[model samples]
Target: MLDFFTIFSKGGIVLWYFQGTSQIFTQSVNSLIKSVILQERTGSNQFTHEALTLKYKLDNEFELIYVVAYQKILQLSYVDKFLDAIQLEFRNKYKDDLQNSALSSNFDFRQDFDRILFEVEHAAKKQIQKGKVMKSFEESEKSKKSVKSMIENKKEEPPKKSGKGKENKPVKKTPVKEQEVKKTSSVPMATSNTSNGELDEETIRKNRERLFGPAKKKKSAADVSKSPKSPDNNKKRVKVGTKWVLGGTSEDAKELDYTDGTADNLDVNGVGVSLKDEELDYVGRMKGELRDVETESESEEEEEEETVTQKTSSKKSSGGMFSMFKNLVGSKMLTEEDVAPVLDKFREHLVSKNVAADIALKLCESVSAKLEGKVLGTFSSINSTVKTALTESLVQILSPRRRVDILRDAMDSKQKKQPYCITFCGVNGVGKSTNLAKICFWLIENGFRVLIAACDTFRAGAVEQLRTHTRKLNALHPAERHGGQQMVQLYEKGYGKDAAGIAMEAINFARDCHIDIVLVDTAGRMQDNEPLMRALAKLIKVNQPDLVLFVGEALVGNEAVDQLTKFNQALADHSNMTNPRLIDGIILTKFDTIDDKVGAAISMTYTTGQPIVFVGTGQTYTDLRNLNAKAVVHALLK
Candidate 1:
């Protein structure tokens, strides 16, 4: 039996519902709305909540969602058909009210719902009853004879040897004529391709040779000792290019990564910030002119300018898929079949733009769901309609859910005599430290005192490099400007210390120094590195940074999902707190590298639902820019 059946609008109006049990389904139903309906994951057939199985169907035209819930232990085959039946019946009964956009929950649908539900369930029961066996007298004890008697009946006609005289001689193989009769009566071990199913002469010859073949003889030890052994036999063979050698020197140890402890004896790439002071800014550039991010395009006309794609151009454009729709003549409602081939090509086009395969597929599903039943206008083709829907969906995903005003938030934190801490984390070589420097510059340019937290003690020599950045940033804003105090300070506990403890101490130190903001720099670690990820989670959970930024490369494609998901999952799993601080936002770096494949922006945002706060377009701090969703979507579609 169903626990409940509900009809509700997307605007949270419950039209009508029936409850068969007293159990509260409010939590389960609300969760479905928030996590699925609101999240745009409606392409799924069913959703499970604890002990209940929830199946839903969407009526997009009326913005109605019909949900039915039942116990998972029950095999409710009639639920789907029942939902379809009831939806049609209810829509027909209230067709006049719904078409007029009546926004009331007093819908009279109970009688129609019950009648359809009963009919559907009865039909399902009849179909199930057909496959069931009937217990009768023929299936009783006499039909199941005793084991001994059943075997005794067959024993009387036991095997009769072909000839009594030949049986006494112990004949193994029969004559070819007798064997020819054996093919029909017995299963053949070797099969033949011939129509008669007889073994070919060559097959028969090979079978005879295999069955009566002579065994190979082993050489005796005494005979082997009589002859001298060859030198080639004594010298064991090994792979070429791998000549045996003595123990290697200490210099060879340098090849191994020394992530922890002192390595004075080995030549290594000294760790800290991956970037140098020289890369932060060239000596020729003036430090007085502070440059910030560009939220919009450089030219004012960038918004007004439209990019026209010509179908007849000598160089074929991304309008390749658009041209295919010309053959799909006539205007009508879109079906799954009509849009399947077009969406498949659209899916590939998204993947080509560096969108993750799974993300691209979900986008296509979303597009198909939105346009599945909508009719194309006389002037519009399937091509224009699909393109517009895709553009809107991409823009929606990229749009920030809430404005991230870091300047205002930092100022607010300063008012409370507390530092606004921002932690930077990502896999190795993604330039977390460099981007941190860029962010630090932005904060300082806005006239805020900053503390550099060197929590990346896992890297043996990484602390000093961040110190270099600290010195350069302070040099840009000397002590003379801020009451004889350096605008930026570096707090490092050297290598091989607990990053969590270091960040806690740094925040405390920032409080004491009256620092306006704290920038926590952690060691670069791969997403799959559990120990490091645990340490990262520990730092975030302990410090509870105002904003935790995940730095990623623009050049990354499918790896973007794994990197972000695992990083977020690691924070949630290992934090051990009720509410752990997952990544708050993303910092996409190397924006200058990827040309038109701006799909990374969509891929990262869609994976986490976190806005990309800062985009790193170059090596210098001034290269930072805010994410322009319009610009990114334009590039993606083009």
Candidate 2:
């Protein structure tokens, strides 16, 4: 049973309160609950306060807090059902009052609160009864199974033997046991013919017949243990189709004619003592004739070489081997076809890193054009050359024209006595509010007075979410409380209000209060949403925020480019400016979620020509870090 239930607007304003029987709410207890509600927007739904357990349920416009005090633990499902029912009823009954801030001022919902509680109690009781019936049915089914097993055990028992001297009669076994015995034994079991189950001669004879065949003789253990003898040497070996030749045979040696020794002494360089004078004269005469013939041949060869060279020169001019080879391979100039393989592979590498296909192709093409015809060093291969080129190109693209000097801007705003207004824009679930709070924390740490504006009226709990951040920030760095001025303020007007007007008002308030920086968190809107985009443009135009940083997820790859482009175009058109109202920079959130596919950071910067100012590394406010180009490029390449 609920101890008490309270309904409050998202802004922490109590709308109605109901006290259960024997339940009392002191001032301190009420303050504690309100403090918890203000601090936590989306956390564990239950917390302990004193002796009671406070369970909370949140909706678009209001939050329902139920105080549950019980001796035994209760099911959360029941509590949830009750809370859901009451929340629906209250919202329906007070829709007008909830939407209109004017009516909510004097609205008293205690009258309808009792009726809503009664309906919820009745419905909860019915569900509890249904649960009990299901549990009882399950218990009864278990009991039936236990009783049936006992009866089966009794039926399977056999009667004991009457006398020890009398021949024991075999009892009939159950079919289940019989099947088990049959599966284990290869031979069939013999049954007794007598009704008393006495084994007779015929049963014994049949059992013996089943154990051993009638004609065949069984071998002894000695015969089974002896090994078989080897085959006789004279036995013919099996003749496979292909003959196996082990060593050289005499027939192969005889085919080589080893007996021939006549040519051994016929050496051309050996001296021979013969009738040499006439032979020497003949040799000398032959030598003189050979020399005359050689002279004529040399003259003819020289004339033929000169004629061939002249004919070749007349046909085509002779060029150096290196120049001719270059012309053949076209090494002086490089074409797309020349480096197509390298570019294709590099493009694939970029795509695998989550870079978009077209963007990857463009990067590859740019690299290829720069690398064409360039002589590669001895240590550098095509892959290394391409990687170096890509890294340089990426660094150039990621290097923004102007760096975001947040601290300097804040200081300037402080000097001018006007708050440096920054509006955060992004798609849904890109951590706009969270990053806004992170920036606020950064400003506060830098000794600048920061104020948060919750102008995100579109999303449920958007304002509450920002408020939660501000509460944490204030708790971490408490205000001085001098002259009743807060160091950090969260300005929210609840849901269903003009977000642009709310932002403008917040800015005006910030300016008057001499705040250093005002971080305006806008509702996460898609780039294609025309009306929302126009509204955002109006918000920016009316306030002319000093910095409009686009928050995007690093895991979105090249899609972040398209989103920022469309957003910039929309803002430019709505502002009616010649040049588009460009985003000052990007704040990439969830950077840690994308491990290796960090190419989105490169792609976003490359496509938008904007630098990433800061990155949200984790859930904490301190996780925000400045973006380093070299580290990012190294991470991508590595």
Candidate 3:
């Protein structure tokens, strides 16, 4: 039996021979299982799991041939629609076994499908409830119709039940007649109340009419009716010709259609009044429309206020001005010189004006930092090199005609021209950085790509200070710190002493990048420092920059000329100097600080061959004036 059950699990051809009670039978059941699982059936797998079995008994001289046939069976959830008698044939034949298998089956059909079944059942119940309610409504309507028909029949055959219901009918008729009389009497009261409530101004006229009966020649319809009792009253009623008016009258002006007007007396007793339907409709529609508009407008205003509040909160919590100030101070390109004293003054002024210390500090720092980094930076002068260049070597290039032609050429060459690389050489506090920035601005304005190299890396704020000018001029600064592995390492590498070599490396970098102009701001040293001068001269030789600008403070006095001569001489005689070219131009800064004009004139005298290209009048970037011999003469002559 178990061997036959294995075949029933899935159908296959079974060759079986039972030897005895514990004998085993072997058959090729693989083909049967594969065939049954793949076969197409009428009701699909939902009806029943039916596996066909083919059995044969092998018999030669040693074996007898016998055959047994059965169906493999299993329990499964079936579609109710497919649970027909024909589909249940296998279950009927093996009813006891199949029922036991179904009871023991591990499949949890209800657990998985209960929700969907419940939803479908709920929807069906709701639809049935709706149908029942509709049917009830129809029955009630039918009952109402039946009651109406019975009432009509009673009216037609009043004699049939008249005697039996006579007393009850009289009671109903008496109340009905009294109700009609009461209703008639209350109409006048309602009209009077309406008149009083609506038209207080018309009270006097109304009171006079009410106090007296109808005039003999103008008796009302009510008066005429009462006159039927007396012929004299009838005569009076005929003379009065009774009349009644149903509408109100007012003495005060009333607003109608947004205009002030005396209301027309609506003579209900007569037929002269008229009304327009469109006007009433328009007024009603407009009232509702205006209410809706008002509601929407109020909602919009609330939303706007909330949005503004959110924006204000965001600005407040964002650390606004303070964060901005910090960023400005922390930038890679600003120094003490870049940030001026005016910033502190402004902060103090804000505090004096009753602004909070923290707030004022934040605002002032932000404004000053932006000014230093952008507005101030662009116009701020670390040095005034533009005036120096323009007043000297570039003067011949400044003719209006020449400038105009160059302007045109510059516009065209702007796409092709290589930027110039130059260096400013001078002692400390000579306004080298300030002048270099001013020249950078001039070049940028003239459509030149200018870059500044802060080779004077020894000063604490030297790099930052140089960056301040580049920031002000709004020029591109490609190199930040070039200490190691740089083509030009401005600082010393290890134990090496290669200042000239470092400068050459920087020059090579500029060459490789094809930078338009390289302005190397050399470290401030004494004009008589021969070793430094030699190093600088060697750098100049290697870089071969277009021009060398000499920056000196106007406060240097007569010693300024000597300083100039010394540096110029060194530049001219550095090494096997064939062409004795010394300093190309002179930049005199801080003239505004100098009280003596003679000092400036004497300094100019030292640069006999070299022209004074620029003069610093004040501390501002724009304060440096283009040095004209005539302007110097005026300031000195004055």
The candidate that achieves the highest TM-score relative to the unseen native structure: 1
Error of 2 at 432 (Å): 0.4
| Residue runs of model 3 more than 4 Å from their true location after superposition | 1-418, 471-499, 595-598
Ranking by TM-score: 1, 2, 3
- Encode model 2's per-residue lDDT on 472-546: one tens digit a residue: 566555555334445578888999899889998898898887888888989889999999999998888888888
lDDT of each: 0.79, 0.68, 0.45
lDDT of 3: 0.45
lDDT of 2: 0.68
Candidate 3 lDDT, 1-638, residue by residue in tens: 21231112212222222222232223333333222222211111221113433432212111112233234452212212112321133334444643354423333233323343344446656766777764565557666675656564545644434666653443342212323433655333212334223423354354445555445588788887677564554244435655545323342223223433322432211122232453223211211101100112558758888998998678767976554343222223434355556556544543443334443454434333223322223333422221221223212211111111223433443345543546688887778878776555445434345456666756677765654444333312122222221112122222223545555665566556644455677778787788888877776776676567788776654466567777777877885567755676666777666553423433333333455555666554445455554344323322
Q: Is candidate 1 or candidate 2 better by lDDT?
A: 1
lDDT of 2 at 128: 76
Which scores greater on TM-score, model 1 or model 2? 1
> Could you tell me every candidate's TM-score relative to the true structure?
0.71, 0.47, 0.32
Query: Top model by lDDT, which number?
Result: 1
